[model samples]
Target: MAESTPGFELPLLLFAGFRSIVDQLHAELARQGHPDVRPAHGFAMQAIGRDGATASELGRRLGVSKQAAGKTADRLAALGYAVRVDDPADARRKVIRLTPHGYDVLARSAAVFEELRTAWAERLGEERLRQLEADLRTMAPPSGFRLDVAGWFGA
Candidate 1:
């Protein structure tokens, strides 16, 4: 009979795999001129989206407090990744929008992720990688991706 894998190793392996990918991504990002970007920033930017969002709206989307979201927006603005502009419809409120630099970082990140996936496929064999992805999809929830992972992890 085949030996069964330890249940305890499953979550560890999964987390390690994720960490490895993220670490590599950040390293590449730094080399590509975005040394200030962090994992949480990516989640925050996704919450901000193309149309931009108010601090409260961003907070809700990211499952973080309004204060936390505001801080993130401040950091992004400082880094030149985002800007806070007057809301057109609501003169009392401000909206945070991704700057061109922010969009460039996101685009670079996507390309880097694709390169990483291709490397993984080459290392594991394309078929095996595809099978692994299929298995993960089958095991994972179908509710779609969430931008709140950073907040979830902090909690």
Candidate 2:
């Protein structure tokens, strides 16, 4: 007998399935009264926190068009989650900084993520959770593989 390819392990399908589950989780967040924030907002928040960055810089980091990043910034600004200030180093550029409310929201989101992760671990059991984590880490590219629980659980 020949070695068989594992069924349902196609990378794209796996990613899509995970995405659906994430969508459900986000829906729960929204139901819990989180302000209808998109995945893009979460990505933008992470980028801004990592680097005191300009919108164009965020666009570059996210592999999105500058206009798209600007639009995202606009939404954040309108929601009072961020403000764009003239960059001191470069007059031509502006940097996006989180507002107090944004920081609060981010902190709450962190707590929620921790709670969810703990619940998930409880459901999966320690050994199975560890195995699932290891498998996912192996699948990720070397450069993208972040071993930190924060990165794994996306807080």
Best by lDDT: 1
Off by over 4 Å in 2: 1-9, 31-33, 145-155
User: Which residue ranges in model 1 land beyond 4 Å of their true spot?
Assistant: none
**Clashing residue pairs, backbone N/CA/C < 3 A, model 1:** none
- For model 1 the TM-score comes to 0.96
Candidate 2 local distance difference test against the native: 0.71
Candidate 2 RMSD computed on C-alpha atoms after optimal superposition onto the true structure: 5.5
Error of 2 at 10 (Å): 3.7
